[model samples]
Target: MPTTAFSAHYSRELDVEQLGWLLSGDRPGDDQATVADLSQWAGWIRTDIRCSSCGKTGAQVVRPSKARGSQAVLRQAHFRFVDHQGGDGHHPFCEFYGNDTGEARQTDSLLNFGSEKSAETRAVRLLVCKGIETGLFNQATIRAMRQWFFDMKSESRFKVRATPEALAWARSLQRHPSYRRWTFHPAQAEMPAFDWQAAAKFQFTEENLALVELAKTVVHQDAEWKRAGLMAAKHFGQEVFNTAALQPYYEDTLTLCAFVAKNSGISFGKTSPDYYRFQGAPIPLLALCALMLFTSEWEMNTAIAKFARLLASAEPSDLSLGNMIGLNPFHDYAAWRLVILAAEVAERSLKGFDYQAQLTAIESDLRRQHAIWKSAG
Candidate 1:
């Protein structure tokens, strides 16, 4: 049986041994220190710690770079190795050089943050490794997610909206000597240049994972089957139009239409109408909750609560709002509709609804409605 494990390079092993020196900013070579001993140390671990093996400076221990005290201590308790800038500087024959000593196979070790790769690629790899380390997802599943994200890139050119806070953080890192060193590489070195700034902008947290999950889910169009057919779309328009004129119940039809336009990527370009009217928008917050419901029937309440937190904490770029709004009418509609849905679902709970049963019923109705539209047309 091939157990899944992260690779342990010589540099990481050296970092583990020199935890005392790394934390204290002293000389290296405490390879004998135990995890319990490092845990008991009171000082903080700096990002500019030198490698014990190769004397290479700028090795980052897998600690909470932004956290402090006990929280940082807790985070750094494990000795998972992250990539250092440029390279690990180990001799070619060193046991840790490009080594896959972790429980996982050699192939699984391909997603290395330390390698000379693009910042976007490193960010993706970081997410996968963090997901595996934290039990947010399995390695295999995250690998699939990584592949999906790469495959779906459109010439459309997407840029995440950066908040003031994100920008400030990036600025602070740019000013720091350690981070500056890590971000910059000797131009003529064999190492590939990377965007360290971009990597630093994304954290391997639950909120980021949700954002990534949304991107992956939207691109995959997993909900395509539930989308309204041409007839269904026309019929839905007709029904909404009639109801809007006749009753308050039908008033939500316009809102629903608007939601479809915004959340279904209409602003970006042409997209299926079924996205908005029949299947519902895969809004990052809502889609995350919905995915949880589909995967784990018992965790419904937890998923709903998680959705609420994600919605509240979300940044505009986190939801892809920048790309979906302000460029055209589609953008305007999507931006507004997302605001509307957020208000509507803010305090709701999922306890009363059997989501599995509801999904099955909705899918059936969609097929029937689409068929009716086709026949009438």
Candidate 2:
């Protein structure tokens, strides 16, 4: 039987082994690892995720027409992935759905430290994978489920036959040595690129999955943690615009930031000053990783001010340095705001610092900036 799949527009059909390579091939020998049981994995992924391609069903599928709002978090990516196929005049081919990945949530402090649209930044792949039951969904379904990824913002420019473009995009990410060597090429060399559209995939743990659920349940789920994440994204969108576009690094960082803050409770202990210094020395999501300390307004201002100097003086390629010039308005503004805030907070110290005042100033400024941006239109 052809199976009761949700949707398809394949120029061709893929067999089980081919599909296995498609599923785990991104990880060098991972494809070989799955060759024997890939169908089982694919099935699990497919049947478990929300089947958004055809109907309003599965893990997180909602009608395209019914879907609204901008996928603001995903900086350089396309919109078609999250909102249905035709949400913003895009086609409806990939019909994947996502949910929460349940991970841990925060560390407390010495009667000190501190801390809201707590929205769920959708990472459909992780969502579906986390939601999948170990024994229920099948491998075929998993492969089919991933079809939803095609709908996501393509990694590079769009063309009807995107295989080459996608491969090029993957190769261009050569700066990220981790994925370049191990995670991206296997699928293409072995399974064939674009056998399915060059769909970009994302995943998360079950704990993260639950946190997302919590965010949706109440606007006040994890106040300080969520705020920290927003600050980090804003930091990326605004000042650290390394390239003309604040594309590549924002989404993942946001997820990671939010994940770390909320989960630090059981996962790691309270973040200390040492942690901040350790991060200051590197870039890549430094702002987000720093999310642990901004419990109060004062820490935020000091952090931002310190960051500005880092931007002004540090070697630009320092991962954090590159982020200073990335792209994305939200990211830029926050980063800039922090620089300013950090400076102002430092001024409050007997040494020229006031912890309490720092937090207050930041909140006030965040509100003002947010309003300005909203009205700039």
Candidate 3:
């Protein structure tokens, strides 16, 4: 069983809570009719839902049945795989395979270990920072950390903070170590300064410059490009237009370049409105470049260059590229594929450690984490 599934219609993953909200006709901004009845909703889930990890259809959403004229709720809704004639089902690597219950228990326990101010939490944060600085952590460790951070935000019961220095180190390593949404948390509020400083000081090697030049010659209309742009804009609070007219505009790219150039100064800090305005521009561009890799017309050199620019922009500290790609490794098989492609590119072009092997290790660790949790449970 799984708590999250991907909805093809939305081009994004939705958790059981979001699905239940939609089925109750209370989804904000959703104009479509919803099935208020749990039974009907379960039928719809069978038809519409797919395993986020395996991308296989036939996953069913189960909600606690409401007694006639009663209001008490007993349990939360979740997704479970249904039996099919063929062996087509969740992949062996899927986190939900025979370990959902234990995984959930372990995740909850780990997340609730301490509060933001506790010594335990601080020790963990320091360990993460040290691991990043010394290159002691691999892709598996990074993936585990990313999962922990993501669950902290989504689950609502846990709230943890990472120092700006820790976040900067994580970003320098091309790993996202924060949540998707920026809140009023003090630590989060203080991050833009560190992010801007890192971006301004970003050094582009000769190879990086050449790759950027190469990327300029490659351009084509990919639907994923538009979707990436729209989602990025939505994430950063930028105005979005209709998808029909949303293509990669030269002006937007130029604007991004200009923003990078102008803000690449020592004086620009969090207080500057422009810092807030363009701090997040690179993320969408990175998303675009990542999606391009999946298209038939992808260019490896071009992707490497775009990824370089994303690093120079420095706004990715608060957002996960995996999440922006909408193929979280825990839920979507495509995420593993994307990681493999990205690892290959990074190995050849990007600086840092053996990210190629490290990225692949994320899948292994995800499986291992489930097994450990199941055994402990």
Q: Local distance difference test, per candidate?
A: 0.28, 0.26, 0.35
Ranking by lDDT: 3, 1, 2
**lDDT for position 220 in model 3:** 21
Q: Which stretches of candidate 3 lie over 4 Å from their true place?
A: 1-3, 8-13, 17-24, 29-39, 62-78, 82-96, 105-327, 330-377
Candidate 3 lDDT tens digits, 53-122: 4566777655433345864333334466654653435554344444333222212111211111122222
| Model 1 agreement with the true structure over 220-279: per-residue lDDT tens digits | 122221121221232222211111111221123323434434543324124343544433
Rank by TM-score (best first): 3, 1, 2
Q: Give the TM-score of candidate 2.
A: 0.17
Query: Estimated TM-score per prediction?
Result: 0.18, 0.17, 0.27
Better of 1 and 3 by lDDT: 3
lDDT of 2 by residue, 227-326 (tens): 3344344333232212212222333334444444453332223443234222211121333233212212225444344333332442222110001101
- Candidate 3 residue 279 Cα shift, in angstroms, is 25
Kindly give the stretch of ten consecutive residues in candidate 2 with the minimal lDDT sum.
109-118
Clashes of each: 5, 77, 3
| TM-score preference between candidates 2 and 3, better one | 3
